[model samples]
Target: VDDLCDRAVKASFASAGQGSYGEVSVLLTNDLAMCEFNSQYRGREGPANVLSFPAHLRSAHSRVEVEPLLWGDIAISFDRVKYEAKCEAKPIRDHTAHLVVHGTLHLLGFDHKEMLDIAAMKRLEVSSLARLGISDPYSAGVNVELSAL
Candidate 1:
């Protein structure tokens, strides 16, 4: 998991043109903790597969001056990852890698609030995952179950 996370973070940073000097803290937890975070931070119920809390929200074009930048925190629900992977018929590692990359992109100020933004984010995610030998998660064959992340 640690190795996968390292690669995913590196790939995500590179894709966002953030170089490879930042730090990202990842928290692997269960559904209960994730549920609490989802409610408190997102004002939503139940657990999300992953959520990002940026140390300083900035787009790829922003100039960052902090030495050894602390990018952000990523909270991942292990239970949700497992469930989603099972539902999608994908390897757990692939699912986890995708989520880590997605959360890292979010930390880099990439959002899906608009259609263009969603496409841009997904492109970055697919390319970053490709660098890590993971496939595009948004492929047509993938199934998104209601309870899955």
Candidate 2:
């Protein structure tokens, strides 16, 4: 999981034209915990595959000088990710990597609220996943159940 998180983060930074010198928390948890977070933060009722909470909010107010930027926290639900992977006919590792990349992009302030934003974000995810040797997640008949980030 740690290795996967590292690769996802690196890919995200590269795609975003940023240097990867920050710390991001990757929490691998279960469905119940994720449901609670989803409800509390997003006002959603179900568990999402992944969730991101950016640390920029803290840096915006803090005066401390840190070498590495503290990017954010990403929480992933193992059960949800697994289910999604199976449903999409994708390998679990590939699906997990995609979620990490998605969450990292969210921490960097990338969102998909609008059509243009969705296109841009999807392009980044596809490119990053390709670098990791994964195929385009949105290609052909693939259906990815994405959550609101």
Candidate 3:
């Protein structure tokens, strides 16, 4: 858990750009809590691997310093991470790094709804994880060619 938090904080700060004092809290909780958060904040039902609740409520003039304000919270499901790691044959730490980076990217106004946007977001994640010595999560677990079976 310590390692997870450390890596997540580093990733969040790095992706937030320079002088970004945003503080993000990463929570490792059970599926029940995750489900509640998902429904309450996202209007969805079920436990997701990771969810980011950015300080969404901001005034028009808040953009200049949104980087320094308390950004938001990211919730991750440990069980899901472990299952994914084992299934994909990757270390849990690496998977955690990917998820953290994913959530942080969301904080930075990146999304996967568009191809170009996805490519850009992925590039940033790959580069950021490299700085932390984490493997390329974009092509790891659940990414291997298991069709041979």
lDDT (Cα, tens digit) per residue for candidate 1, span 1-149: 99999999999988888778878998889999999998988888988889898888576546666635687899999999999898888999998898898898888888877688878888998999999988788785674522211
Error of 1 at 54 (Å): 0.3
**Cα deviation of 55, candidate 2, in Å:** 1.1
* Per-residue alpha-carbon lDDT of candidate 2 for residues 1-149, written as tens digits (9 for 90 to 100): 79988998899878876667888889999999999999999999989888989877432113335524688899999998889888888889999999999988887778877788888889999988888888988985776667736
Expressed as tens digits, the lDDT of each residue in 21-62 for candidate 3 is 657677887778877877887777777788876665433223
Candidate achieving the largest TM-score: 1
TM-score of 3: 0.79
lDDT score at residue 114, model 3, on the 0-100 scale: 62
Give candidates' CA RMSD values in order.
2.6, 3.7, 5.7
How high is the lDDT of residue 112 in model 3? 65
Number of colliding residue pairs in each model: 0, 0, 0
Per-candidate TM vs. native? 0.91, 0.89, 0.79
Ranking according to TM-score, highest score first: 1, 2, 3
The weakest ten consecutive residues by lDDT in model 2 span: 58-67
lDDT of each: 0.82, 0.83, 0.67
Question: Over the full model, what C-alpha lDDT does candidate 2 score relative to the true structure?
Answer: 0.83
